[model samples]
Target: MRQVIQLRTEQLGATARTTLSARSALAWALIELQRHEEAVAQLRGLLPLVLAAWGEHHEAANGVRLHLGTAHFASGRPARAEELTRVVLAVYPVMDGLRLRAWTLLASALSCLGRHREAADEYTALLNAASPVYGEDDRQLLWVRTDRLHQLAFLAEHDLVEQESRALLAGLADDDPLRAAISGAHAFVLNSAGHHAPAETIVRAALAHHDGADLCLGLARSLNGQGRHEEALRILTDARTRCRQSGDTEHVSLLHTLTARALLGLERLDDAETQARQAVEAARTHHGPTHHRSLEAATTLASVLAARGRHTDAREHLTHCAAAWRRQFGPHHPRTIATDAELAAVPKA
Candidate 1:
C-alpha cells in the first residue's frame, strides 16, 4: 500500500513540469519528501491552470484546491490555505474527500494561528467525516483518524481531554503498531503540554513496543521535554549512528536536530552548533531545501548560531527559513510563527 502510494506520488512528479498531472505529481512527491515549499509552489502554479480549464466549481478544480490548501498550510500560509479550503468545501458539499482534506487543513491553519478552539472544532469534524468513510479497521484510515485525535488532544487546553486522548491512543497499542508509534508522539505532545510523568510512562511503553527510528526519536523528544537532556542526547546520538548505517539520511538529519536540541539544553554550545550545522547540510542534501525536515534543520542551526552569540548569522538563517517557510506554507502557519519567534528571540548587539 505504501509503495503504491509512493509510486502514484512519484508519477505525479515525473509529469509535473509540462502538465497538470505534473503539478499533482510534484505536490504528492514534495509532500512525501516533506518539502512543503516546493509542494506549495507546484500546487500554486497548477491551481490556476486547473481552475481555468475546469471552472472554479468543477470537481477537478475542487480536488486540486484541496491539495493546494494543504500545501499552503504546510508552507505556513494558513490564512490563504484556509480561504481556499473553505471555498472548496463550500462548493463541493458532497465531496467526502474534499471535506476531509479541507477540515484537516482548516484545523492546521487554526492551530498555526493559535486559535485552539477553532482548530479543535475542525479536527472533530474531520474525525467525524473520516470515521464513516474509512471505517475503524483500516490502517491508513486509522492513521489519519489518530492524527486528528492527536491534534484534538493538543488543542484540548486542559488535562481532562488531553488525558482522555492519551488513554485512547494507549489502548490502540495492541491493535495498531503504527498507531502505537503515534501514541508515542501523543506522549511527546503531552510533555509539551506540561504533563511530564504520564508522558514519560507512555513514551517508555511505546519504546518497548516499537524499535523504529521515529519511535526512538519520539522517546528522545519526550525525554528532552522532561528535561532529561543527557538521556535525550544519548538516544539521539545512537539513533543518528543507526540511521547513518541504514542509509536513512532523513532520519539522520532528524536525529541530528534532536541531538542539537539536547546539547543546547545541556549548554554544550559548541557541540550543539556543530550538530546543528551538520543537520542543515544533511537535510538540504538528503531531504531538499523545501522539505519540512530541512527547514527544521535550518531552524536548529539558526538557534545554535544565536546561542553562540552570532546574532547576525542567526538572523540571516532565520530570514531564509522564514522566506522558505512562507513559500511552502503561506506565512501564517504555526511552524512559521514559531520560526518567527525564534528569530525574535535572538539578541541584538
Candidate 2:
C-alpha cells in the first residue's frame, strides 16, 4: 500500500467500514493515477465491506461493483469485468449514470471476448437508452458512438462505418474541430476500402484544422497505407519530436511504432527493430502489455525481428500479440488475425 493509503487505513481502522469510505477513496486515487493493478487489489477488499455495510441491493454496493469492474477492465481482465458488469446491470435500479456506463463496459467486454455481433447489439441497446437521456452530441453518447464505429470498422462493415461517420459529421460545422476529428475518423473506412489517397487527403485536412496528436497519427497511418513511407516517416518523426518536447509520452510511443513500420517499408531493418523495441518498451511503461497499443507495437516489432532473421524474437512477440489481442480486441479482429498469421509463418526451432 502507498503511505497515504496505510495512514488512512490506520485512521479508519482495518476492521471497520465507515461512512468516509477511506478504502474506496484510495481505490479511486489509484485508478486516477493509472495504477490499475493496485486499484484492483484495493477494490477487491473494499467491495466486500461496502456490500456488508450497505447490503447487496444497496447503491453503494452497486457502485463498488461498477468501479471494481472498471478497474478489472483497465487491468486487462475483461472476463472478470464482464461478469461483474453483467451482475450489476441486472440489479442496479438507475438507468442513467452507473447503469449507462455499465452497459457501455459490457459491450466492450463482449467485444474483447470476440463476440462482436453480441457486442454490437449491446451497443445499440446502450445508444437507444442513452440517446433520450443525453442528446446525440453529449460527450458520453459520442464516446459510445465512437466505440460502435470502431467495432464496425473492425468487423469490416466499412460502408456502415462510413455512413455513421458521415452522420456524425453532418451534425457539426465544417470549421468545427469536431468535424475535423470526424473527418479524420473516416480515414479508417477509406483505408479499409482501398482509398488510401483520399484517406491521406482527409487526414491532412484534419491536421490543418487542429494540430492534434490523433490527427497527426491518422495522417501518418494513411500515408503509410499508400506506401508513401518516406512521407510517413517524416510526419511521424516531426510529431515524435513535438510529443517528446511536450512530454506527451503516449503519442511519443505511438509515433515510434509508426516510425518502425515506415522504417521496415524502407528496408531499414536494424533501425526498424531498434525503434520497434523502443516503442514496445514505451507502450508497456505507459499502457501495460495487454493494451492494444502495447500489443500492436510488439506485433510491428516482431515483423522487424523476422525481417532480420531473428525468428525466435519474432515468434515470441507474435505469441504475446496473439494472446493479448484475443483478450483485448477479439480473435476475429484484424489485428489478432494478422498476428496469428505471422506466427504461422515463423519457422519452428
Candidate 3:
C-alpha cells in the first residue's frame, strides 16, 4: 500500500509540475516520509510558482503559503515559516482549512521562537475556532483541542492542564482512534510532569488501543518515569522492532533515542551513548540534521556525553542544540531557554 502511494505520488509529480494540488500532495507525502528538508525544498520551489500562477490573493495561493510555512517550520526555519503563515492569516479571515492550519503553524513557530505567551494565544484562538467548526464532541475537534492542551502544558512546564485535558479526552468514545492517540500523548505529558502513577495507567490503556509507534514510545516514557528502566527498555525494543517491520525508519530512530534514555536510567552509560549516537545518525538520514527528530536525538546524545564526563563533546552537542533551537523556535522560547540552561551548566574542562 505504501509503495503504491509512493508510485502514485511520483506519477502525480511528473504529470503536473505547476498544479498546486500536485505540489501540495507531494509536500504532504515528504512530511509523512520524514523527509523534512526535502519537503521544505519542494514547498519553497512550489510556493513561488503557485504565487505566480494564482496571484497573491487567490485562495489557492494562500493554501500553498500555508503548506510552505509548515514545511519551513518542520525543517527548523521557524522565522521564515512564521512570516509566511502570518501573511496567510492576515489576508484570509475564515477560509476553509486556512484559519485553523495557519493558527496551528503560527503557534508552533512562536513556541519554537521561545515566545510561549504568544504561542499560547495562538493555541487559544485555534481551539476556539476549531471548537465552533467541529464542536467539542467531534473527534477531529477533540484532537485539535488536545494539541492546544499539549502546547499549554509545555509552556506552563506543568501537567495540571494536561491532566484535565486527558480527563476530557478519556470521556470520548473508545472507538475513536484520534481520541485514543490524544490520550496516549496526554499520558506522556503527565509523565513528563512527574505524575507517574496515573500516567502509567493511561498510557497502558492507550497502548492497548493504539498500535502506533508513538503510543508505544509514550508507554516506554511513562514506564521510565516510574523508574522501571528495564521495562522501559523492553517496551522501546519492541517498538523498535515494530517500526522496522513496518518500514517506518523515523519511528525506529525515535525508539533508539528512547532506548538511549532508558539505558541512561539503568546507569549503562556506554550503551546509552552508543544508542544516542545511533539515533542521531538514523534520524539525520531519515529527516535531515535540521529536523526536530534529528535535533532531539542529538540532544540525547549530548546528555549521554555529559553523563560520561565528556565535557568538550557535550559542550559541542549543546552548542548545536542551542543554535538549532534558536533557528527553529527563536532565542527566547521556553525550549530554547531549557537548552541554553543545559549548555551553560556543562562543566568546563
Q: Write the per-residue lDDT of candidate 3 for residues 109-177, one digit (tens) a residue.
A: 776665555777787777776776677676555656666665555444454566666577655666667
Candidate 1: tens digits of C-alpha lDDT, residues 1-349: 5455445545665353246655687687887787878887788777776665556787777878877777766565777887987887788777366676677777666655545456666766766767767775555555555555554544333454455455556546454576565665577556556676677786677667666677678778777777899988788877777777775654777788889989999989999999888888876665456666687788888888888889999999998998877766556555677788988888776
Q: Which runs of model 3 end up more than 4 angstroms from their true locations? A: 1-54, 70-79, 109-118, 156-159, 245-254, 279-303, 306-349
Clashes of each: 18, 0, 5
**Where is model 2 more than 4 Å wrong at Cα?**
1-26, 35-38, 109-119, 135-137, 174-181, 241-254, 277-349
- Model 3 collision count: 5
Superior by TM-score: candidate 2 or candidate 3:
2
Model 2 / residue 140 / CA error / Å: 2.0
Which ranking of candidates, highest lDDT first? 2, 3, 1
TM-score of each: 0.57, 0.72, 0.69
What lDDT does each candidate get? Answer: 0.70, 0.78, 0.74
Q: Per-residue lDDT for 95 in model 2? A: 71
lDDT score for candidate 1 against the true structure? 0.70
